[model samples]
Target: MDAAPIIVHRPRGTGGRRVTVRGQIIGLAHSDRDLIEFLRQSGLDETTAEEMVGSNSAMIEWRGGRPHDYAAA
Candidate 1:
């Protein structure tokens, strides 16, 4: 299957992280759970979604902040 890479951008003023793929915004996540749900909705299963959000998976590019960090700095 072909899919655009995921990018989790820096947290915004509302402490929500913008999730995108191929420069298209997909959704905003306030926590890891929200991120996982987005991944799941994008075709990943539960375990895979959790792993992708927890680990530094190459499929996802985390920008401006580390994983699990949702508070704007």
Candidate 2:
């Protein structure tokens, strides 16, 4: 992933002016998901993968999707 980070925003505007915007960065729990997978393929088990991956909540909240949905898919 790009270490520089990302931005999300909502903008409101009229012919006269603009207003009401919000933004946030989407980031990994640690180095990135690829790094986690690398460790796992190298023999790290699921338990350690969970630890290294940190949190999935970031994606869940950003996507407004439940954590279980990814697994089901």
Candidate 3:
């Protein structure tokens, strides 16, 4: 069976929101630049980081209590 989708809603003007999936923070970016930095900090390749910036949302997979993997959702 497939797992349920993770949804993160960050309200405007709140300095961004913390996105936690399965008790882990998978989404930490609030803007395009922030996303780029986040992705780069997460060890994602340049291509993947660029691709992620174009996406409206993302799906992340956790492993060992950390962001082990992710894909544009």
Candidate 4:
């Protein structure tokens, strides 16, 4: 796996996945759009954030679930 800086952690029991950038929690994301917004809030432009999440960029590490998988477990 790539040593990515952005991490979308496992889905929680209630819902959503915790998102972290450089080890700092950004927010919980239930969808790609939410993830993009969190990235934007972290100083990334909307277009860039969208692209990053959409393309499944190597900068992000998806754990315990595939991208877009946010159902409670």
Q: Choose the strongest candidate by lDDT.
A: 4
Give the better candidate number (2 or 4) by TM-score.
Answer: 4
Q: Which stretches of candidate 1 lie over 4 Å from their true place?
A: 1-4
RMSD vs true structure, all candidates: 3.2, 13.7, 9.3, 1.4
Rank the candidate models, highest TM-score first. Answer: 4, 1, 3, 2
Each candidate's TM vs. the true structure?
A: 0.84, 0.27, 0.45, 0.93
Give the alpha carbon lDDT tens digit for every residue of 1-73 in model 1: 6543999999898788999877777799999999899888887898998997777788888888977898866
- Candidate 2 has an lDDT of 0.32
Output the number of the TM-score-best candidate. 4
- Each candidate: what lDDT? 0.85, 0.32, 0.47, 0.92
After TM-score superposition, the amount by which residue 15's alpha carbon in candidate 1 deviates from its true location, in angstroms, is 0.8
Backbone clash count, each prediction separately: 0, 0, 0, 0
Candidate 2 has its poorest 10 consecutive residues by lDDT at 12-21
Which should have the higher lDDT, number 1 or number 4?
4
TM-score winner, 2 or 3: 3
True lDDT of residue 52, candidate 4: 93
